[model samples]
Target: MNIKEKYELSSRYETAKKDYEKWGIDVDKALDILKDIKISIHCWQGDDVTGFEANNQELSGGIAATGNYPGKARNAEELRKDLDKALSLIPGKHKVNLHAIYAETDGKFVDRDELKPEHFANWVKWAKENGLGLDFNPTIFSHEKAADNLTLSSPNKEIRDFWIRHAIASRKIGEYFGKELGQTCLTNLWIPDGYKDIPADRLGPRKRLKDSLEEIFSVEIDKKYNLDAVESKVFGIGAESYTVGSSEFYINFVNKNNLVPLLDTGHYHPTEVVSDKLSAMTLFNDKVALHVSRPVRWDSDHVVIFDDELKEIAKEIVRNDSLDKIIIGLDYFDASINRIAAWTIGSRNMIKALLSALLIPNDYLRKLQDDGNFTERLALMEEFKTYPLGDIWNYYCAKNNVPVGEEWIKEVKKYEEEVLNNRK
Candidate 1:
């Protein structure tokens, strides 16, 4: 940024720091903690969830990324380059969440069930070179195998067995990623196995799903290398009437299996919020995984903003002191705008929300509630909102060597002009 902008940001931050000190909130400590919280940014945003798989099939799951924005990454190389630009603008070191469909298979056909660590060798190498960690997911959509909307829970033993092998293969790939990067890779399983209309036999499918999971997890994998998590969804486009992997089903299965239960913010009814569920999950489970997204009326996967729920989610994590125990990851893909901007904006807002949470004097608020001073507590909560959080956020971006404020937008425009626009 220009010299004038730098001076203004610093001046504003100094004033904000003084205001925070009065509330017993240490700005420096908050920044330190924020820097350590590494969010796993999903790679699908760059390519509109269209991975490097050669099939060129349409997205079939209940999920769909709308808009026809130009310059979507056509291959793994372009996707990585776009991600590099996005990460440059976002502050703090973070991890990249990848799907099995994004595997660089050297122009060879590698089905999901037969996938191996070699298929993702390039991804591991790229992540290491970029100094970022990696997380993984099994691609259970946009394939002939999943055309029926029945994967692990399919009544057909052969089809169910295929997905089970795929899940096992995905875990092995996650293990490879963790081993190479010296960090545990979260391997999440989310299958769009549900019926479009009401089915007479709901129990049968869930039972089969349980057996499939049992088979997938039968082979022991070291927790140090790979952490397994199961995600649940209320409904999907085709699976409106019944979803095999419902929240209740996954929660019970995860608890029984001693696996992490992943709660996707967009995977619930419009009235339900994952922020309210965080405390309970953290209390019960040793570690929890999150797929952070903005859901409109349904699981629309809108770009995340600094909305109330985002702040509440961040507050829950910070207040409960469960930052280390929570696995934070972004799960959204908006194709209408500049893909890089989508990534930068969502990631920055998430960090901003976390910073806001960290800047709050949680102990003081809790003490007020405990002392039955509800009026003072409510007033303080409202007053905290007017604090100069932008100043602190700007200082953070500058300190991290990322562009301060709107300056990053200029870089994105330049990239589009020089690079993204060149794609035919």
Candidate 2:
């Protein structure tokens, strides 16, 4: 077996061991190698069988409440329960994506009545008490005028004010979460302040959003708080149509703000820009984290698929050294049937894609390093494009795949022996 096969086999064993541990089943074998698998799977509150079965079992994290879920926690008390449930499912080291507040005047952002320190204190306390990890994503469009919901209004003052307060509050929240949790604060800031009917050069809202972020970073959040600004696409109708979270804007905004950019795959799949999305992310690997979920053209399916199109995008992300930035959480809507199972299936497919990326022959990558040819690298990607990304994993994992495991372990031993002999 080659080096890639060696690592793949070792990874499979390590993940299997971890999976067994969850059910109180221990594997009596060497598992020192899985210590390096840094990938994480995303989970949400309602996810049940589908999401669970599809989960990497080896690596999983708590779910984040998508702002649209009306039944989810909107207050500290509700959040505590949410945190508790999430913590109960995963291992001790997993994390949770916290929806800081529903950003509508009619929602939690305003219901809290001017965003007090205690409201946030409640969240921090809950996380600490439950040992649940927390992340942040603001629902900025919740308060817009009924008619002007996801776009910039004529005055746009209320929206601007909402964001100003939100930015300030988020910064404060980031600092508190970081100091209190020892875990970095991840703020997924989605810009809903855009044009609806006609393009609005209403640069004021954009400027305020950016300035607020910069000011927050300057004034709050320790270096650990990764303020990942997410640009999301909103799906709706006529007067309320919105799509500010596109590659066109995010690439420039992140570069300009000196903050990390987050891309939601579902947001752009409808636009046929998945490849461009990957290209932009590749160039900005140093400043991007992926929100990987399935997108069905016009809607945010949040389903995960190993579709050929997404498969290629996944390859590019892994090839570009950006897998570390990926947070594999399901963006599934709570109202969907078998929602949890959907998340699991999607997550399973997602892990398969990630494994495929990991198994890509290192020699091919090394050749790119040696040649320093950018075009050649892209061509190489095209060359190995047809391989079933995750099926290699299923082949060994679905049954008594022990032979696959032994063959791989031997390969690793051979590599180790070669390296030790060379050193001597």
Candidate No. with top lDDT: 1
Candidates' lDDT values, in order? Answer: 0.94, 0.48
* Model 1 misplaced regions, further than 4 Å: 2-4
For candidate 2, lDDT tens digit of each residue in 328-420? 444554444333233335544555565555555545656786888768777756655654422345333433222232243353345334432
- Give the per-residue lDDT digits (tens) of candidate 1, residues 1-424: 6899889888999999999999888899899989989999999999988898766678888778899888999999999999999999999999999999999888788888999999888888999999999999999899888877999998899888888999999999999999999989999999999998889999999999999999998889999999999999999999999999999998899889999999999999999999999999988899999999999999999999999999999999999999999999999999999999999999999999999999998999999999999999999999999988999999999999999888999999999999999998
Candidate 1 local Cα displacement, residue 374, angstroms: 1.4
Q: lDDT of candidate 1 vs native?
A: 0.94
TM-score winner among the candidates? Answer: 1
Worst lDDT window (10 residues) for model 2? 52-61
lDDT for model 2, on a 0 to 1 scale? 0.48
